[model samples]
Target chain A: MILTAAFFSAAIVAGTPLLFATLGEIITEKAGNLNLGVEGMMLMGAVMGFMVGLKTNSPFLAILAAAVAGGAGAFIYAFLTVTLRANQVVSGLTLTIFGTGFSGFIGKGLVGEIMTVDIRKFFAPVEVPLLSKIPIVGQVFFHQDMFVYLGYILAVLLGIYMYKTSKGLNLTAVGENPAAADVASISVSMYKYLHILLGGALCGLGGAYLSLVYVPAWQENITAGRGWIAVALVIFATWNPYKALFGSYLFGGLDIIGFRIQGSGLAVNQYFINMLPYLVTIIVLVTISFRKSKKNSPPAGLSVPYFREER
Target chain B: MKKQLSFLLVAALILSLVLAGCGGNKPAETPAEKDMVVGFIYVGPIGDGGYTFAHNEGRLHLEQELGVKTLYKENVAEEDQEVMNAVADMIDQGATVVFATSFGHMDGLEKASKEYPEVAFMHCSGFKMTENMGNYFGRMYQARYLSGIVAGLKTETNNIGYVGAFEIPEVVRGLNAFTLGVKSVNPEAVVNFKTTQTWYDPATEKEAAKALLDAGADVIAQHQDTAGPQQAAEEAGAFSIGYNTDMKAAAPGAYMTAPIWNWGPYYVTQVQAVIDGTWKAESYWGGMADEIVALAPLTELAPAEAAELIEAAKAKFISGETDVFVGPINDNEGNLKIAEGQKLTDEEMLSMDWYVEGVKK
Candidate 1:
């Protein structure tokens, strides 16, 4: 039971960034734009957040700066794909390259620079009042950092916005068949732009969480391709925000199992355990395809740039 | 629409030009046009805060000491095509010496050296080289052993853990030396190590460190690049040893000591040899005695006796009283590695894939 709780705690720490990126990407994909730039955006967000947090010593401002940086990246992609009709895949790839390069250029100066701030206490465990008295479950869920709590809240809010609201239906329609949505005067471009920007902002917040709370050290390319894992997580979650949270934590669990189960008399190869996340992603993708629910499929027009002039 | 297409094309062309410009920082000014231009191809960005950062520090030292114009391409992949292009570009940019600073970059460096015989080549931690090429690395294991003494004295659980970057001989050698130091000081302690299989993944490094913490290790050490392991140890209320640099700030409470590289002086010496036209293709391996690798200052978390213990060992290294790979050594499996009174040679140490008695991989 102790080991299990320890493992769950590790999962929360590992999964928070992935959850942020997956939910962010889900929103963009739901608006018919498949942004492959999450990795780039995350790096930009990480460095920008680190800079702000270090300079201002204000976590809130740092988080905000990261969001803006990420959104700025998305803004360029939106203008290229949505306004200029550039290919979505190409534009997204370009954004990734741009973000990675720009972040590295700026971060080179701060290399080997250490954060002397004692802001770790701010990100330290916050136990829920009263619920903390409970046993294993309480310790695992209620005792976590503010960023982990934010991940939960974001998933919940995103789920409601995706499934329960009228705006959600309109956005889904725009993604499914933009011409029909346009005929109904739904303003397809507005939804695409807004959702894409929102996605970018959320992705940025995810990166800020990494730099500000998780790891809490400055390293170049600190996202470490976890942004790509987050992108894969969107497919695993089947566009459901809540499922994305679960999937992210699942990857997180697989990530640490190699270490967690060590010296428990189990003789497992660490390399095979290390491959669990990607291997599980492939398996989940295949299983999702076998499902009969069409709702479980990707956004109908994802990666397609809509052209009003052609229609 | 045709106008829009042309406009888009123009935008893309401009963007490409800007990104291409960002790829290589302008080479520092050449005081004399005839001064040799040295180039570097780094495996990761200079801001990696780990291996690449250490190398760049050396390059900066080279520039300052030798006054040679230096050019470098950060984030160059060790993949054949990318490194080849980078090397070719550096040569075109008038580089007389190109240093490829990654083991994975060895094949690419070999190819580049063959193509440009006139241009001297240097690599870090690899064996293969041509007449105009040389490989240089410090005996980081010596420093690793000193840091291990810190961990051995500090750990209350008698369980030590290491987050190694890879299973290569260099890392293996460091881990063995560390285990030897640990057992030498605290015979009851054993060191368990796991590989992240990556040089610079902070997330995985932290998780691996945490996993070790959960496994009851009170002392954590890392061969990985980032300070992730140190930070993780601090968060878990455990002690840690860092690598590549002083990681005291990364984990103030947990950091005990670290094996650090002082590449600046080494770079000066190597470049000076080249300037004197005495450069050879011999593999150069310096140690603590030469000050190529040294132990970072012991953190306050280290035991009171730790400093004295580590310092005595340091004096032994400097005075030629101790060798890192000395006799009566046994493999982790209890098989005899070195006969009593017989110290292992540089050739044997360089190819070591086995662990010392106290190591559990």
Candidate 2:
């Protein structure tokens, strides 16, 4: 029972970044832009975040710098795909390659470098008063850092914003049919630019969350393909923020479960256990494709660049 | 329609050319045809300051000692087609001998050796070899034994954490050797292991070390390709024994000693063998006596008697007076692995799959 509680706790810790990145990409896709540069943006955010966070020793400042850097990283993809009218897939992939290389280059000196400051206390778990009396639920969910609570609030708030607000409907309209949205007087470029930047910022924050609250250290490729996992989670959840939250946590749990089960005196093959997450991803991707609905489908104008004059 | 067809053809041509260019990723450097060049493929970046860094140092030494130019491709993913492409590019650029580092590069190295029969291919830490291909690794377990002695004496908790990269034979051998050293000095000491199953992930390595520290481990030993574990030990104010290279700079306050690799001598020999037409298919496993594996300098935090113990052990190993795997060995589950008065053969040592007593694997 104690082991079960710790395993679940580890799940939430691993899933927080995925939730953040998925949320960012969902918002971006809803704005009619399929930005596949989440991995690159996350890497940029991770290095810059660690650099700023380590230098200032202030979590807030570090996160802000990471977000800004992530935003700046996405600005390149936005400019190429939105302004220059480049192929979205090509531009996004280039951004990933460029971002990955640039971040690695910048992080060259920081590799093997240790932090002088101890920022663990700042990002440490803050148990909720009175609610801590509960069993596994309280230990796993209620006893988390500000980033987790931020995830809860952000998920609920983003869900409401997507389904309830007039602006969100307008954004959805732009993704479904940009010409129709333009006819209805919604600025396509404005929405795309805003959401892309917003997505980049969130992805950056996710990266910061990884380097700050989770591991609280800096290293090259520290995101370790988590950004790519977020991309897959977005699809697995069918662009729903709530589903993304649950699915991301499940993956996070699986990541830790393999080690936990082995450590619990099982003679299981570690390789087969490690392959669980990717194997599950394939299953998720395949199952979701069998059922199609208006709500379940990807945005129509996702990878298509809006050309108002062509219409 | 004709103009549109021509445009499509031009686009296809441009696309193919661009794809071809991307496949060649290496810079189109036209070296003097007569210049003798050796190629190196690194799984991680050279700046990693651990595994790749150690190999890069050997490459630099090989260049200086042999007066030959060395070219390298860094950050090549061993599992990706990058390995094949990088090796092919090296061949195209007139490389005579290629050193492919990382176990994941095994299949690729084998394929490349068969394809480029004229080129001498050498792989690190792999078991595969061909007519012109060879695999070479040092007996790092000897140095690991010495470092373990330091950890056993230095640890007040008698609990040492080992952050292992994988559950492979090399790592298992190192773990057993280390446990033996620790037990020889401090019989009550026990080693716990946390495997990340990755070679160069810093964050995971740190997390494993932290978990060990949380479990009351006072000393951290690791086989990963980074300084993250060493740094983790530093942060936790615990002692560390790093692999591949010295952890003195990575964790000055926590560094005890490291089982380090000095690949320069072997690399020079390989290059000289190729030049002298004496290159052959052989599995090279040099030990402490060969200067291929040695312990780093003991830091101030290490036990005072560690220096003397290591000196005596080093001399014994050099003189074949001691074998780390000699007789009376028991697996971690308390099963006798090697019988009394038996010396473990190279095959048993190479394919070691069980943990020694005192190791929580």
For candidate 1, write residues B1-361 as lDDT tens digits. 8698879879989999997877547743434567878888898877777788788888999999888888888878878778889889888877877888888888888888888888888888888978888888888999999988888888889999999988888899999999888887999999988888788888889888988888789999999989989888988889999999887877888888889988889778777877788877778888888998999887678888978888899899889897878989999889999999999888888788898898877
> Model 2 chain B, TM?
0.89
Report chain B TM per candidate.
0.92, 0.89
lDDT of 1 by residue, A1-311 (tens): 32678889888778999888888899999999999999888888888988888888877888889999999989989988898778988888888888887888777776666553656677788998988668977888889988899999999998999899999999999988898899999999999999999999888888877788887867777887888888888888889999998999988787777765655667887789867777877887788678856888888888888988778
Tens-digit per-residue lDDT, A19-91, candidate 2 = 8898989998888788889989998988888887777877778878889988998898888778766798888
Best by DockQ: 1
Model 1 CA deviation exceeding 4 Å by range: A1-3, A115-118, A265-267, A309-311, B1-23, B28-36, B79-95
| Per-residue lDDT of B203 in model 1 | 80
Q: State TM-scores per candidate.
A: 0.93, 0.82
Q: DockQ of candidate 2?
A: 0.37
Where is model 1 chain B poorest over a 10-residue stretch in terms of lDDT? B23-32
